[model samples]
Target: MTVVTSDILMDKELLHKKELANSQAALLNVLDDQKKDSEKILKKKAVDEAILASIGDGLVVVDKEGKITYVNQSFEKMLGWSSKEVLGKRIVAVVPREDEKGEEVPFNERILNKVLRGEVVVTDLTNPFYYIRKDKTRFPSSSIVTSIVLDGEIIGVVETFRDITKEKEIDKAKTEFVSLASHQLRTPLSTINWYTEMLLTGDVGKLNAEQEKYLNEVYRGNQRMVGLVNALLSVSRMDLGTFIFEPEPTDIPLLVRSVLDEQMPHIIQKGITVFPTFGTNIPLIQVDPKLLRMVVQNLLSNAIKYTPEKGKIDLSLTLTDEKKCLLFTISDTGYGIPKNQQHKIFQKLFRADNVREKDTEGTGLGLYIAKAIIDNSGGKIWFESPVSNYIEGEENVGTTFYVELPCKLLEKSK
Candidate 1:
C-alpha cells in the first residue's frame, strides 16, 4: 500500500472527469430536443383550434367517460357554453338532451355513450331530439356522432350537429306547395284521361282506326302523368311528416292478391311463372292499407318489368319463426343488380345501368317511396341480388326483396 503509484491515481481522476462531462452533454442534448418537441406540439394545437373554429356546424369532442374534452367556437355559440365551463364536466351534464319521446336520457343511455361503444349515428332526421342551451331554451337539432377510433380502439367520440328549425320550416312550405300543385294538376289530367278513354271505348262515338290509335297514346300519356303526380304528392307528405297513418284491420293476403292481379297482364306478356305461399293461420294486423299497397305494387311491378320470359317469381307472406314480425319476400328471377351499384338502389331517382337499358320507363322513385313508407311504419326493407343467385349458366339471374314489419308497429326508439 505504501508503494502505490501517485501518478496513476491522478490519471484515473482525469478519466473519471471526462466521462462525467460526456454524460452531461448527452443530457443537455435531450433537453434541447424536448423543448423543440414542446414548440411543435403547441403549433399543432393552434392549427387544430383554427380548423375547429372555422366549422359552420357545432362540434364537440368527448372522452371515453363522456366528459367534455374539447368544443369548437360554433359549439360554444350554439349551446351558449364556453369550453372552460364544460371541459371537465360530463357532456350530458351541460346539454340536458332529450330523446324523441321528450324524456331526458341518463348519461349511460345517451347517444354519446352509444358512440363511445362504436355505434355511428349519422344525421337522424327521422328521429331527432331537443338540445337545451345554457339559457335553458331548447331547440330541435339533427346530430351525427362517430367514434374516435385509435389503434382499433374507440377512445372517444366526436359529434357534429346543426339547428334544423329553419330547414324544417322550409320543408313544410315546400311540401304544401307540392301538395297544392299536385292536386291542381290531377284534376285536368283526370279530365283528359276520361275523354281519351271515352273516345277509345266508343262511349261518346265510334272512332276510326287512326283516331283510336292517337287517342290510346293520349290516354297512356295521361296515366303516366297521373302516376308522377301521385308520387310527388306522396313524397311531399313524407317530407312534411304529414302522412295520415290510420291503422285499420287489414287482410294482407287479400291485399297482396289484388296487387298481383293488377300486374297479371304484364306477367302474362312476359310468360313469368309465379308461386304464392301464404302462411297458414296468418293473423290480421292493423296497418295503413294505402301505404302498404304502394310497397307491394312497387315490388311486384319491378319484378314483372325486369324478369325475362320464362322467369320465375316467388312471393311469400310468412310469420317469422319467432312469430313477432311479418316477413314478405318477393324473389324474382330477373337481371340481378350489379354488385357495385346495389348500394344506390334505394336512393331517389337512382337507376341501375343494366335495368335502365332494358326498361327506360322507370321513374327510379319506386324503391325510394317504398323505403320511406316502410320506415314510417316502423319496418325494414332490404334486398339480396347477386349473379350467384341464378342458375350455373345464367348471369344476373335474379333479385329478392324482403320487407320485414313488426306484427304491431312499435313506437320509435330515438
Candidate 2:
C-alpha cells in the first residue's frame, strides 16, 4: 500500500512539471512574434523618413557636434559637395563668414557663440553666402540657418540655401526696362503737351470757330494721353518701391472745391449741371493733397464723360458717427455700368464693353489709378448703381461712386 501511494505522488508531480513547461513555451512564442512586429514597424518608419529627405528642396541634418550627419541628394547637388566629404565636418568649413565688405572672413568664436546662443539667422535680400565645394572652390549662396534643439538642450543647426545669381540678373533687367520705357514715353508726351498748350493759348496764332473746335479736340486728346502716361509712370514707381508720398494738413472741402473748379470747363461744355453740397464743419485731414485731388478729378471726369448732355451730377460730403471717416460721393445721371461689368471697372486695361462701344479713346487706367491712390492713402472705395431710374417720362439709370478716407493721418502719410 505504501509503495502504491508513492507512485501516485510521483505521477502527479511529473504531470504538473509538464503543464508548467507547456505554458512557458507559449509565452516565448508570443514574445517572439511581438519582436518581429516591432522591427517591421521600425523599418517602415525609417523608409518613410528616407523618402521625405529625398525631396527636391535641400534638406540637412546635423548632430550635437554641428557636423553634417544626414544630407539629401538635392542638398549635395545644390552646394556641389558630396555627403561623404561633408559628413562629420564642422559647418563653418562649408558656410564661411562674410565681412561687411562682402569679403570672405575667417570663421572664429563669434559666429559659433551666437549660433549656440539660439539665434536663428536669416538673410534673403543679399545673395551669395560662401559655399565650399568638393573641388575646394568657394561659391556664392543664399542661405538660412536655424538651430535644432531637443529637450531644452542645444543639439545642432540645419542650413538650407540656394544659388540666386540668375534671379538677380532677371531683377536688374526688369528695372532697366521700366526706366527706359518710362523715359521714352515721357519725352514725346511732354513735347505734345507743351505744343498743344501753346496752340490753345494762341501763342502760335489765332484761329476761326471751326479751327478752334478742331484745335480744342486735339488739345483734349493730348491731355488724355498725358493722363494715361502719368498713370503708367505711377504704377511703375509703385512696382519699383519708389513711389513718393508728400503729405500735409489739408482742408478736405477746399480740395474738393479745387477739383470742381478744374472740371468747370468740361461740365459747362457737356451741358451737365453740377450740384455740390459741402459740409459746413469738416475737419482738415492729413494727406497727400495731390493724390486726393487726383482721386476727385478722376471721379468727376468719369461722371461728366459717361453722362449725356443736359444730365445732372451731384457731389456731397458727409460725416457720420458710424463711419468716422471723410466720406465723399459723386452721383451722376449718366449711362449706368452693367452689374456684371462693375467688378472689372477697377482693373488695369479693362474697359466696360458698353463704354468701349461708345468711346474707344479711353486707356481704361483711370479707375485703377484712382483706386490705387485711395488704397495707399488708407481709404476705401465702392459704388452703387440703380437698375432703373424714373426720368421725365422714362427710366434714366446711372451709377454713384463713393470714396471714404481715414480721418486721422496714417503713419506713412508723408
Candidate 3:
C-alpha cells in the first residue's frame, strides 16, 4: 500500500518546479519596483539642488553647530568664496557683518546665532548691514534667516542675502536732494511768514477784521509749512550722519514740567484731564537737552492732538527700579493705533489708516523723528495701544509711548 508510484512522484516534482518559478518572478518584480523608486528619489533631489543653485540671491545652509553645510552658486559669486572652501567652515566667521557705523556685529548677536539659540528674528530691508567678502571688501547686504526645523527640533538655519549697493546710493541721493531743496525753500518761507505777520499786526496798514482773519490763516499755513521743512531737515541730517549731540546735565523733571506748561493751553482747549506724576528721588539725566525736548514735544503733541475733548491723559516721569535709567511715559485716551498697522508706526511718512481718517493734520514724521533722536541718544522708544479697550468701546481707546534713557552721559557718536 505504501509503495512508490511513478505518476505520484511526477506530480510532486511538477508542483515543486511551479512554485520555484513563481518565487523567481516575484523577486524580480520587487527589484524592479525598488529601482524605480530609487530613480524617482534621485531625480527629485537633483531638481531641488538645481533650484537652490539657480537662485539669484546668495543662499547658505548651516548645521546646528553653525558650520557651513551647503552654499549655492550665488553665494560663491557674491561672497567670492567657493563652495568647496566654505563647506564645514563657520558661517559668521567666514562672512563678517558690520553695522551702519562699520562696527563688527558681536558673535552672539548674529541673526543666525540667535536663530540657532531658538530666537525668532525678523529683519527689514530698511535696516541694511554690510557683509564682508573673501577679498576683505564689503557690500551692503539685506538678508533673511530662517531656522531649519525637523520634528519639532531645530537642526540648522538657512540664510539668503542680496547686495543693496544701488539702493543705498539711491537713498543717499534722495536725502541729499531733500536737504538742498529744504534749504532753498527756507528763505521764501521766512519772507512769507514775516510779511504775513506784519500785515496781521498792522505794521504796514490797518486791516479790517476779514483781512486780519485771512492774513492769520496765511500765517498759520505758512507756519505749518515751516514746521514740515524743519522736520525734513532734521531727518536729512540724521540720515546723512551730520546730526550733532550736545549733552548736558539736564533736570529731567523740570524739563517735563516746562513741556507740560507749554502744552497746557492746548490741554485746556481740549478739556482733557491731565494727571502729572513726578516720581520722588528721580535723578537728573545727562542728555542732549534740545533733542530730548523735541522728543517730549512730539509725544505730548500727539497725545493732546489725538485725544477727544474731556478725555484723560497721564504723564509720568520716574526712574526704573534699578535707578539706572529714566522712564518717561505719556498715555492718552485717544484713537488707538490699529493692530495691523502698529509695526509701521515709526516708519518715515507712514500714517496709520485710523489716524489719517480721524485727523488729517499729521505730518507722519513726528514719531519717526522722535525715534531717531531717542536712538541716537542711546535710549529706547516704544509704544503700546490698548486695542482691546478700543474694540470694547472703553474710554481708554488710546496708546502709551515710553522712552527710557540711561542716567549717565553717553558718548556721542561721531
Candidate 4:
C-alpha cells in the first residue's frame, strides 16, 4: 500500500531548496536597501554638523525640553563654555540675560519660551540684550531664536547670536572722537559768532544797510554752525558709556520759555503762531536741565521747520493723572509724517521721503538724538501724524510729538 520512490523524493528535495533560496534572496535585498538608507542618514548628519561648525556666529540647539543638545565651535569660543560642558544642561545655564538697565530678565519672559511655544518671533539689531559668559564677564549680544518645527509641532529650538563687544568699543571710540572734535571746533565757531554779533550791533563798528544785510547773513550762517556743533556734542555725550548726570529740582515752564525765546527769530521769519500751555499747579520736578533743554529745542525746532508758513505750533507741558510723570507734547500744523514711515522716524540716519524732499539741510539726526536723550533720561517718546496733510498752501495736516518723563528717575542710563 505504501511503496516510496527515490525519484519522487529527489524532486521534493529540489523544490524545497529552491523555495528557501528565493526567500533568502528577498531578505538579502531588504538588508542591502537598509544599509543604503543608513549611509544617507549619516551623510546628512555629517553635512549639518559641518555647516554649524563653520558659521561665524554662535549656534545652539536645544531639545523640546530646553536642554542643550548641541553647540557649534563658534558658540563654545564666544560663550567661553565647551560643548561637552553645555550639552544636556539648560540652554540658559551657560549665560543669563539682562536688560540695558542690568535688570535680570525673568525666565518666563524669555526668547526660549517664546520659540518653544510656537509663537512668531522677530529680533532687531536695536533690541540687543546683555549675556554673561562662563567667565562671569558680561557682553552685549544680538540674537535670533527659532524653533525646529515638525508635523506642525515644535520639536526643538535653534539660536544664533554674536558677541558685540568690539562693535560697542568701536562705537564708544567714535563717540569720544566726535565729542573731542566738536569741542575743538566750538572754540573758533564761538569766536566767529561773537565777532559777527559785535559787527552787527556796531559794538566794533557801525555799518550801512547793505553792510548790515551781509553781516546778518554771515551771523545767521555762524549761528547755524554753532547749533550744529552743539547738537553733535550732545549726541556724542549721550553715546559715551559713563554719562555725566546732574539732575536737579528745576522749573520746566521757565526752561521751555527760554528755549522759545532763543528760537524767536525763526518764528518771526516764518510768521508762525506759537501756543504754549502749562498745566495749572504743575510742580517742580528733578531733571537734567541740559538734556531736557536739548529735547525741548529739538521738538520745537522740528515743529517750526516742518510747519508751513503761518502754521500753528502748539507746545504743552502737563502732569499725568497720577502726577508721577510730566508729559510734553508739540503739535504742528504743517507736513505730517506718513503712517507707513512713522515707525522708522526715530531710527538713526533715517529720513522719510516726504520730509527729505522738503528740506535738504536736515541731518536726520535731530529726532535720533532727541529720542536718545529722552530714553537715557528715563522717558518715553512717540509721535502721531497723518501721511498727507497738504490740502492747500499754508495748511497741511501735522505731526504731534509726545514725551513722558518720570517725576523721579528710573533705572535708566546714568
Q: Kindly state the number of residue pairs that clash in model 4.
A: 1
Q: Which scores greater on TM-score, model 1 or model 3?
A: 3
Q: Considering summed lDDT, which 10 consecutive residues are worst modelled in model 1?
A: 387-396
TM-score of each: 0.81, 0.54, 0.91, 0.81
How much lDDT does candidate 3 score? 0.88
Task: Give lDDT tens digits, candidate 3, residues 233-306.
Answer: 99899888999999877888899899999999999998999999989877566788898999999999999988
Alpha carbon lDDT of residue 398, candidate 3? Answer: 86
The candidate maximizing lDDT is 3
For candidate 1, lDDT tens digit of each residue in 193-295? 8878777889888899999888888888889899999988888787666778876777889999999999999899989999999998777767788889999
Which prediction has the highest TM-score against the true structure? 3
Each prediction's Cα RMSD?
A: 4.7, 12.4, 3.0, 4.9
> Residue 382 of model 3: what lDDT?
99
Ranking by TM-score: 3, 1, 4, 2
- Superposed model 3: Cα runs more than 4 Å off: 1-10, 388-396, 410-414
How high is the CA lDDT of each candidate model?
A: 0.85, 0.74, 0.88, 0.83
Model 1 ranges off by over 4 Å: 1-26, 88-115, 118-146, 338-346, 387-395, 408-414
Evaluate model 2: give its lDDT: 0.74
| Candidate 2 structure quality by residue, lDDT tens digits, 236-260 | 6754657788878888888889889
CA shift of 305, model 4, Å = 1.3
| Separate clash counts for every candidate | 0, 1, 0, 1
